[model samples]
Structure formats: structure tokens, C-alpha cells
Target: MSQPTVPPLPQIFNFLQLAAQNPTQYGGNAADAPELTRILQEIRDLSIPNGAQHSAQGLEPYQSIARANNPTWNARPDLRPKISKFRIVKHTHWGKAYWSPVDLLGLFFSRLEPAPLGATVRTFFLPMTALFGRWAFQLVGHYAGMQSCMWKIQDNGPAQFFLGASIVGYDADIPTCGNWRRVIQKARYSLLPNESLFLRDWSFANSPHGPIHPKDDYPLGNCAELYPYLHLLRGVDESNKNVYGIALKKKGVRSPSYNDTLQGSVWQNVQWPCVKCRELIHIQEGVLANFAPYAGSKGAPP
Candidate 1:
């Protein structure tokens, strides 16, 4: 079945007067007709997922990692798990993008309560906190996605250097079961944390947890976003060396040095981070986020 056509945005809305045919409608034409039409088309394209859509995807609720593993919010019934597992189609395939200034402005109004889930149960989250700036991307025992960057300063520094994160978790309140695929198109700043080896070892690789073949190490292994900021995800110890107490790297992840070995886009699946890897990454990042202190190599405010 086809989605119904969304009504185009009217030109000359309010006092803005975008694309006026007469030129006298609002003193002078503000924007071109093509541009106004494009504006409407953008809104028409925003495919924000409904709650059922989210549930069907089997997006995890954060109860697995919340304080004392508490059930934060419970729906009366878990939407019967949809047989078609989740996959990362392109943003255009999903038709999810902001339309106009209204959508941009609406970003501020949305609330994405930032929490560390890259390690476990923060269900797919990206918060508006990215806009406020300077807060750490707190990763605990689980990895939950959020709008955070590598803060290179501000432990006590008078000035903060890192630029701000883009608007995250804006369109919806992505519950614990929402927001994990980590390959958000508009939000590149968001990190992709799914790097479990068994995830990539599907077709050509062995799964007893051994060195992954090149074919099996594609998605999170080549991740461009997380490679640079993983230190932020893994906090520092008192002595300051990258502490890898969570899981054995070779057993769990694909490669140790993705920075030098990175070839192409991170998680390059048509829909990125396969279902197996998605679940694993969430669990892995969930555990990794819980470590105390920033990573030993954790930049003081990079």
C-alpha cells in the first residue's frame, strides 16, 4: 500500500510571504516558488516512526541498564515482535528529514534526555543536549546513543573548545526501544557503537569468536564516527591508559586500530549494523559506558 500524499506547505504563510506570484502579496517575493515547493516537500517527507513501528523493530527498552535495571516506562503490551528484523536503509528510503525553519525550531522544543547507553539499555536515543554543549558522553556498562562529542577541555579549564553537537532526538521521544541503528543521516555526529565480531561474521567468517575475516569486519569495524570518539565512550582511569576491562577486544571486536585501517563509510550495510550486531553492540556499549572516569587516553577537552 502507498502512503497518502501529504499536503504541500502553503506559500505566504504568516508574514514571511515565501514565493508570492503577484509580488505585492507581501511587499515583495521572499523566496522563489521552487524553494517554497521544496519546503513543503521536505515536510511531506519526514517519516517519523510511530510507536508501533518502533516496537516492531524490537528496539530495546533501557530497563536492562537503568539504575538497578528499573523499568522506566512500560507499555501495556509489547507489540508482537515483527518477523522482518530491523535493517538500516538510507534516510531517503526512510524519508526522514526536517522540512523548514519550523522543523529546525521544533528541534529545541523536543526533549532527548541524554543518558549513556552505548553500553546497555538507553534504547536508541539522541538528545538535544548536543546543542547545549560541554557535557561528557557518559558511557556506562551499556551504550546508549546521544548527542555528545569528544570534549578536549573543561575538566577545570576556563574555556570549552569543542564545538556543539547538532539537534538530536528532536522529532520524537525515542523510547528505550527507539533509536539504535547509529547511522542517522542528518546526525552524523551521533556515534555508531556496534562492533561485536560475531555480527560481521555472518556469511564468510567463523563465529566461535576468533579473528574476523575482512568480509566479516565491515560495518562497525570501518566506523568513521566512533573511531575518533571511542575514547569519550570509554572513560579514563586514575593513571590514564585506555582501560579495556569490559570484554576481550580480539574476542569481541573486529580490529584494534580502525583509525589507520579505516577504509570506507562506517557500518556500510544497505541498512547498517545487522540485527545480530545491533543487539550485540548495544549490549557491548552498555557495559563499556559504565566504567568510571573518562578513557585514559581521554582527551582533556579535545
Candidate 2:
């Protein structure tokens, strides 16, 4: 005997169509269910892809616009997205300076892919991606701001030195940026080529963590390479604006959704995030809980 075949998305799309048309028949009310309404609105705003083009690299992100590979989705070939790298500066508490390459998507609850999703997949899940897209843009902006997440791949010792001197998950609750913003405002120091604003708070400069490299009154234009961190995030792009328009424009959007974390078989794999990535995820959850518009986190007490 053959195994049962699952219905195709087109068939499921039909069920969704009928369900949206007459929710009461299914004993549900669209007005009462925000999730259903978000889905239906997304279905209404979907883009119809014209055709597929062959590319040197073929890739599909798990969600929508994430360009970073999901370490968690190794078992699913359908979601082998490319990993995007972003660099950040770091000053070890020991006074050594270093540049760290971070997996852009691994830092957040998102993934990155090449351009233009398949027509069917895009139509089905683009709206759903609002959950990720909204958080991603906001998180990126936060990362570009004063405080952000950093990871240590090795250990911190005089032996490790710049190789990495701290425990992988020792939270650097210490400040990453201090006052380049104010320094620039007052022209206290000649800024480097793209060093417009600082990404850290004021205390970062004096933090026990070694921030002694950047000078207060000098032309860093010559010593540009000295600062480790850079101001990365700017703002949301137009693509994100159109994507999140329908799916996450409400108060509930600020709160975490069931879709925020990896779901289903993806978690069964052992290639999960390392301690550093897990630490970043915990930071994101805490941020959403404390700052999300609804004023609470899913992890909060009822």
C-alpha cells in the first residue's frame, strides 16, 4: 500500500479561500481572531511572480528576506539560504582590540536569502514573513544603536589574547559604545571615514572593559583602523515597509508570535545554534519582552 499524499498548497489555498469567505461556517469569526485576519490580509496583498530565472546560486530562505543561513535548518534542503556576514568591533576587558565577523541572520530571529522567491512560495508565505521582517528591521536598528550582541568563539586568557579571551557566553553587559556621537557633535576628534555616530552609550569609554584606543582630541582619520565597532543599522528599507504593511501593523505585532522561533521538525536537528547564538537569542527575547508595545513577553508570568 502507498503512503497518503499531503494536499498541495494550491489545494490548501482553496481551503483558506473558503475559510476566509465564510468563517462562521467553520465556527470562527475573523473579527475575533487576529491571526486569521492577518493571514487573510496577507493573502489579499500577495504578489504574483511572473516566472523563475536561473541563477549561478540557487537559494531559498526559510522566511522571506533573511539573507543569512539558518544553522537550524540543515535537514531541509528547501531552505538552504546563504549566510550574510556583518562585522563588529570589540575591545576585550584585557585591552586588546579585534574585529569579529558575525553571521548577520544568526544574530536575530531571521534568515537571509538571494532575491525573488518562487511564485507559489512567495504567494503563500510572504505575508507570514512580516513576523520576521518586522522584528528583523527593528532588531537591526537596535544592533546599530548604542548596545548590541557580541559573541566570543574562543576563550579569554593571556594565552588566547585576541584569539578570544572570554567564556563563549559571558554576557558583556558592559557598554560597547560610549560617546563618539557627542565627540563628533563637538568636533572633539576628527572622525574616520564612515564614523558618523557611535553605537554605544556614554559609559562605554570608561567601562572596565578596555576602551582606551580611541583618542579624545585627535585626527582618527589617520588611525581609522583602531576602533573595532561600527555603526551598522540605519533604518527600515522600502521592501520591508511593503512586506510588513498588512501582517504586523497592530499592537499584537510587537509581541512575539508562535512563528518567532523555529517550529516543527527544524528543532529536531542537532546543528542548533552555538552558545553565542543562543545568548543573542536570549537578548532578543528580553528586548521584545521589555520593549515590545504590548508591554510584556510571552515568557512573562500570566
Candidate 3:
């Protein structure tokens, strides 16, 4: 007697469809419950070539628009050298200067494709300080608050820094604030040669302050609320090197969506240091602390 043959992918999908239609014909285990089986079949069907064809057809218009407006819509793989040579700037505040252990761990764990539930849970518990620092950097440092250390990318070049507006969409005029209206408008407009665009899906209603409209009127002025970490766009080739290409908008008469509601600046292609640089920074920090003059001593470096 011959051994039973394993089914091909299409055949497997057909079997799932049949099992979903008639659950009793299968083992009827909990995994093959009617609802679960139906969902699995639906997913399988969507993965087929025909389903993909339909999806592509539906997205054709959007793709055309994106290509026309965004230079990076179908950008060739960036072949720039990985930023291995870099220095970390020491900040007065440690939290502001370096990513916390939890923040770094969370970022690492998130890159695990098809991560397990336990790993996801652990990643979620990481502190919000990293996000807070990002927000503060945008609101305080970029606006009218204290200046802080920014990362250097190449030798003797201007410091590359992260700005929230670069990650979250913002009005061309309000450089630091994130607004859905401006995001939508930019999606439709043609991007300038220097502008680089990225699309991110956001749900303002799901934020801690509860459901709110982008145009809601507040008594004291509508200040954006702080949100938890999602994901940062890193270089595809150098996953460890956090960097984005900067997009600068041209000066023009303001549109309604581009109203200057806030005072701040935006930057693009911001690069954060790699693990090795971070470790060296920690060591440097230790040395600085140890060699520092005694507190309350005269003529000590500030």
C-alpha cells in the first residue's frame, strides 16, 4: 500500500473552503469551529492571485497619484553606506540623551516578524519616556524651549535630529503639529523635488483624550495630546541605524490647511545611533560622571 499524499496549497485551500461550508465533514475540533474555519477560508481566498488582481485594480488610482506626487513612492533601494561612524552627543538629562533599556528592548522585539504573544506583551510594557522625549524635542527644543544634543550623521556635517512632525504628518505651516487635514491634503498635492513623503495610518479617536475632531475648538487652544509609541521608520538596509530622508517644503502663500497655528521647525532623514554607539555613549557617560569635580566646588565645568 502507498502512503497518503499531502495536498498542494490550492487543494488545501479548497479543503478549507469545503470544511468551512460543512464543518461536520472535518474533525470538528475547536480549531475548525465554523466561525474560525470561515475566517481562515476568507483569508486563504484573499491570498489567491485573483484576489490580488482585484486589489491592485482598486488601488490603481491611488498608486498613480502617489507616484506622481511622492518621489519615494516607488523609490529604488537606497544603496547609501550604513552609518557605522557616528558619535552620540551627551545631554544634561540622561533620559533625553539615551534610549532607556526598555525602549531599546521594545524596538528590537518589535522587528521580530510574526512575533509571539508573549514577546508582543513584553514590548508593550516598555516605558513611554522615549515617546515623551520625542514629543518634548518637537514642542520644547524645536519651538522655544531648551536646546539639546542632536545626532551627527557624517564627519563635520550638521546634526541630524528626529522631529515628531517628520514621523507624524503636519501642516506645511505648523511644522511641529500633527493634523489629519494637512495629511490628507498633502496626499493629493504634488510633492516638490526636495520633499519626501511618508503615509501613516492614525486613529485620533482612539487616543487617551477620547474621540475628538481635527477641527475641534478648544478654549485655551487645541494642544495635541501625547500618544504611545508605535513604530519608527528605519533604513531598510541598516535596521539598527535609525534614519529618514528629510523633505523640506517651499515657502508659499498659505492654504487653509497649512495655517501657521504653531511655531516650530521640521527635519527629515533623522538618524539615531546604533547599538554600539549607544553602548559607547553609556561608557562615556560613566567616565564623565566619575571624573567630574566635586559638587559645589568653584570653577567646575557646567
Candidate 2 similarity to native, TM-score? 0.19
User: For residues 76-189, what per-residue lDDT tens digits would candidate 1 score against the true structure?
Assistant: 325312111122322221123332222222221111111222321111111112211111111111112312222222233221111122222222224432332222322332
Q: Which tens-of-lDDT digit does each residue in 1-302 have in candidate 2?
A: 01112234345346555665655554445453443443433322221121111011232211111122233344443432321221122312122222111112111111111112231111322223233222323322211101122111122211100000111111111122122223232221222222222432213233222243444321221111112111111132221111110112222223333222223111111021222222222322312121122221123222
What global local distance difference test value does model 2 have? Answer: 0.23
Q: What is the alpha-carbon lDDT of model 3 when measured against the actual structure?
A: 0.24
lDDT of 2 at 166: 10
TM-score of each: 0.20, 0.19, 0.18
**CA lDDT, candidate 2, residue 157:** 19
TM-score of 1: 0.20
Error of 1 at 68 (Å): 33
Off by over 4 Å in 2: 1-5, 30-38, 41-302
Candidate 1 scores a C-alpha RMSD against the true structure in Å of: 18.9
lDDT of each candidate versus the true structure: 0.25, 0.23, 0.24
Which has the greatest lDDT?
1
